[model samples]
Target: MTDGAPPRARSARLCTLARCVALAVALAGCAGTGPGTAPRPSPAPRTTSPQELCTRLVTHWAHRLLADADGGYGDYQSMGLSNGQYEILRTVLDAGRAEERINGAVSAKELIGHQIARSCTERYRGGGPTGGPWQ
Candidate 1:
């Protein structure tokens, strides 16, 4: 099957085909690999509600903010906010009185944020919540 093509050109074509096949095989191997090396792990089957997850994240960040003075509450505000994080913060901060009283059909996100803020306030208010007389 030589249509006036030089030997060098034919060799180059063979090389290109070989390279393409090798690449295809490599990609196929990657596809068979288990989750260990998958491009993306299937998102954890959401056993809990979004509110729950958001709340947990907010609480965690808030605690971190209070503990890490260099970070501060501002950090909590943006910690894990994907897009709509304001609602969580507003609800948590304004819904209840004291950090402990944050309740009543509260979203998980709200509870988490409230807890964090409460912790910080409690620590700052003086001798450690309830005036336990500093340690």
Candidate 2:
């Protein structure tokens, strides 16, 4: 339906309509919540168990220490390992070394993994150290 309007007038009307539509869309988003609306609750954070944490730490350091015989990673405290974890590492490494000599590096690495998992599980079986905090 032409209203005998000039092209400029038609274009201006279209522009105004577009602006109104945009404003309506923008306002619709903000209409979801009012002043009385309560905020959504966030999800609770997940926590790692002591056994799992010990397993990860021991596994990481065991691999590194096994690869480098020069003790390049520093002491137990520097490596973020407790005394108990360090003892586990030493025990695993000794077995790992023997395995490496007889079977190979691959076999020794596999043994390290198994030993670390088993030892860590046993260590945290009673909900972690009983002797002291450092244990």
Candidate 3:
């Protein structure tokens, strides 16, 4: 209580306390907020998904099979298909061969789209698989 203190002295003391409180508040706010909003790190570059990779593989093999028709019968294991995927690939190649026979190689490539999608989608719908990464 200022009791009988000089008004000017009391006013100065109050002003000093207000300033100190303001400074403390400002510093506290900064500490609570930590660094000002930092630029978020750039997102990882987009890459092909497994389904897309499957499409690419099946289509590539379909083309290769279409081209040679005989001499290109390499193992599908080397071509990066799982056992289930290899079955689909074989079916796709068979379809592609028929497509090539009927509509020509250009049109044969179109057959790869849905078959691989269906197979891969079913293959992955079970959720994150256990025994393999890309399987």
The candidate that achieves the highest lDDT relative to the unseen native structure: 2
Off by over 4 Å in 2: 1-41
The numbered model that scores best in TM-score is 2
Which stretches of candidate 1 lie above 4 Å from their native place? 1-46, 72-78, 86-135
Ranking by TM-score: 2, 3, 1
Candidate 1: clashing pairs of residues: 55-108, 55-109
lDDT per residue for candidate 1 within 1-135, as digits (tens), equals 686889999999999999999999999877857677646578778485444555555565544443443544553335555333333443444433234344443453355565545544443355323333221
In candidate 2, position 95 carries an lDDT of 96
User: Could you tell me which 10 consecutive residues in candidate 3 have the lowest summed lDDT?
Assistant: 126-135
Across residues 80-133, which tens digit of lDDT does each residue of candidate 3 receive? 767666777878778877887899877777776666777767765664333554
> What lDDT would each prediction earn against the true structure?
0.51, 0.90, 0.71
Return whichever of 1 and 2 wins on TM-score: 2
Better of 2 and 3 by lDDT: 2
Count of residue pairs whose backbone atoms collide, per candidate: 2, 0, 0
State the displacement of the C-alpha of residue 59, model 1, in Å, after optimal TM-score superposition. Answer: 0.6
